[model samples]
Target: MHNNEILCRLLAAATLALGAAGAHAQGAAGSWFGGIGVTHIAPDVSSGNLSPPSAPGTQIDVDSDTQPTIFIGRMITDNWSVEVPIGLGFKQKIQGAGAIAGVGQIATVRTLPITVFAQYRFFEPTQRIRPYVMLGLTYTYNHDEQGSATLNAVNPINPPGGTQIDVENRFSLTPGLGVTAMINERWFVDAQYAKSFLKTKTTLNTGQTIEAKIDPNVFRLAVGMRF
Candidate 1:
């Protein structure tokens, strides 16, 4: 199956399992919560050498993308929980910078980020509003990479035509902070801000490689129901 389809199935199963577990738990600690939200992903992208000595010191920048997000959380304690964050999909634009500045868009790629967070909710458990902090790890899968004609004109090997580029899958540490406002007994609104410290390399079909640091900031707003 497609990766996105696989992700959807995995999340669906997790929700059912967590809900079942919550149904049998007498206390609030084991309760299950699930949410859907819109997330904005902004990348602080920087690169090193599109091609050393040839296109020497050519750097690139990745533009931002936004997508829908889904997450499920299990309350481990009155003040702590574990949550998994998943995306519908993301599309980013790669632009030339520094030595290759103003070359416009060089490529485009789609990404899926898989992340899990360990969160600490502050204040009294009975309060209607709570603020939280979380730390997690993420693995980003990149695919559907395509090159633009502008990039082809600059690349030595594919000077006459464009060729695709591939971005390697990578892992990073994610850290975030957010707040939850209780709407009723089992409903709430959540807003969060997170960042991933990620680095990866991209390889061109012509055998050239470039290293990139994509520390992306994420913003999310969601509505959830607790079981």
Candidate 2:
């Protein structure tokens, strides 16, 4: 009778251990997730020249603008994951009116950049909060507009002389850092920041050179869900 009781107790203990192991396995296997969110990109153009005549030595200050972003990710291990993010956005009203060396009344220029990126996440997985750093690559589409008067200053005004110039595509490097919070089994949120190291130059139809250095830095907040 004592031997029988001992055997029954051992069997019960084994079943409890198996149940606990199963629960842990389920949690780990289902941790993969994806999300969509919006971001704000603040691009600044400094140390360059634009023409208009607001004043001498007057600098153009561009403000921060909002952009929309989408992302999908998968947890490869307990502490590492990878994500791909697509960003579409615009920056308007980058106004700089200053007298040029020879060109009169520098024109106001506007630039818009659209980017897509892929990144890797490194962090320890946790139930509530996780912190990670990301490194990635981005493809950017850049559009720039300048006034006819400004273009005419460099060359005689023709039917196509003053038209807006658009450089549609470019590439750059993306690096970022952020933290993620798991609100529940299915919902999560994240806050992140990234920078783009790309350089672009514009040449007017009149043989004058306008160099635009686009080093974009971005801050983002997003909510996500796991499948």
Candidate 3:
């Protein structure tokens, strides 16, 4: 009789667990959610020049080397959402040689990056964990690279001088993927990765052009509460 009683209790417990899970799932349906996350960007380099005012007989490589970033996202439905993030980033050493004296040397540049994304979740809304993929557009506002450049000239006394050059703003397309795990009715965590694939052209006041390929790969981690 004791063994039968134990079996009955076990079945009852299982039934309760299932009932709770069903209710949780139902509660999640059609609910709106939003989250904030932090991300680390990886450096992406541009190959050859594809834009005009090309630096004659010069080869330059531009790399996006920036700091951590923060992003916000909103779920529009069970499987669809939109995300927009704004952050700041810097460029690594710009190296090249030819036209200008400091043509091949390393210089630094700063940028403001803004992105908008559309995402689609793969799992059911009721589940505690969901995986998703996204694609979107990114815009970058580049500040001038201010550094002294040694001018190419004849005579030591009149040695070519160096001056500062400011670059322009650029835009591009960015895409990525991510996953979100629900911890409870009101809390969740997420991890994501994304990359930008586009080219940008920056013209200097001196009529010199810097062709940059804006390619940034990033990783993000965040914690959030869903209302």
Candidate 4:
């Protein structure tokens, strides 16, 4: 089975168990909460051609990344809340694919995904375990794109004079589901899974472009405190 599938099952089972025997409290109305955790981003990339002046099937691939993150939120009502997630950035490796399979790495880029979610909690505030659904908007900013030596040597579209890449910023719609299990009156554990409907274009300094679908799956687990 896929790793993601396995994780889903594990989290679901844990949530069910917690619902029967867990500690006190909840994110009651007008309350504030915050947490620190780690997140994993896996991009399901659908690559595109490098536009004219390149190999017939020149394409690219993106790898996954993990980073530390923080979350802060306010419960507007007993069943409604808003949250913001923050992270330093995610560094991803860009590699050769399709017709240029052996070319190795093409470039590296760092990205920051900014998002805000409006969520609705399920079950009563006094419940030990609660499930939630959320909808969010994200703005992705990409920077520090540096091409590799392999890319320079295999500059299929242009002469090997050191090519630099720029990936355009994008906005995407995000949707998610999660479960929160209170450990005590002041602490809780939260697990969530979300997906972004995302796509972007990469432009080369040599005047070439490639559009790719980077619909990334985001997974998170956090330990938090309520006040």
Which candidate's lDDT is highest? 4
Ranking by lDDT: 4, 1, 3, 2
CA lDDT of every candidate: 0.79, 0.54, 0.58, 0.87
Off by over 4 Å in 2: 1-32, 50-63, 97-123, 143-163
Best-to-worst order by TM-score is 4, 1, 3, 2
Error of 2 at 194 (Å): 0.6
Per-residue CA lDDT of model 4 for 58-167, tens digit only, reads 89999889899999999999999999999999999999999899778889999999999999999888988888999999999999999888877777655556888999
Q: Which stretches of candidate 3 lie over 4 Å from their true place?
A: 1-36, 49-57, 63-66, 88-105, 148-161
What TM-score, over all chains together, does every model reach?
Answer: 0.85, 0.65, 0.67, 0.93
TM-score of 1: 0.85
Pairs in steric clash, model 1:
none
What CA root-mean-square deviation does each model show from the true structure?
8.9, 15.8, 12.8, 2.1
What lDDT tens digits, residue by residue, belong to model 1 across residues 11-52? 343344333222221215888999898887888776788764
**Ranking 2 against 4 by lDDT, winner:** 4
Model 2 lDDT per residue over 70-174, tens place? 877766666556677765556544443343334443343444443444434444444455556776676665555565465444433334646344443667777
Model 2: per-residue Cα lDDT at residue 226: 75
For model 4, name the residue pairs that clash: none
Question: Candidate 3 residues 45-68, lDDT tens each?
Answer: 554442333444444555434355
Tell me the lDDT of model 2 at 126. Answer: 41
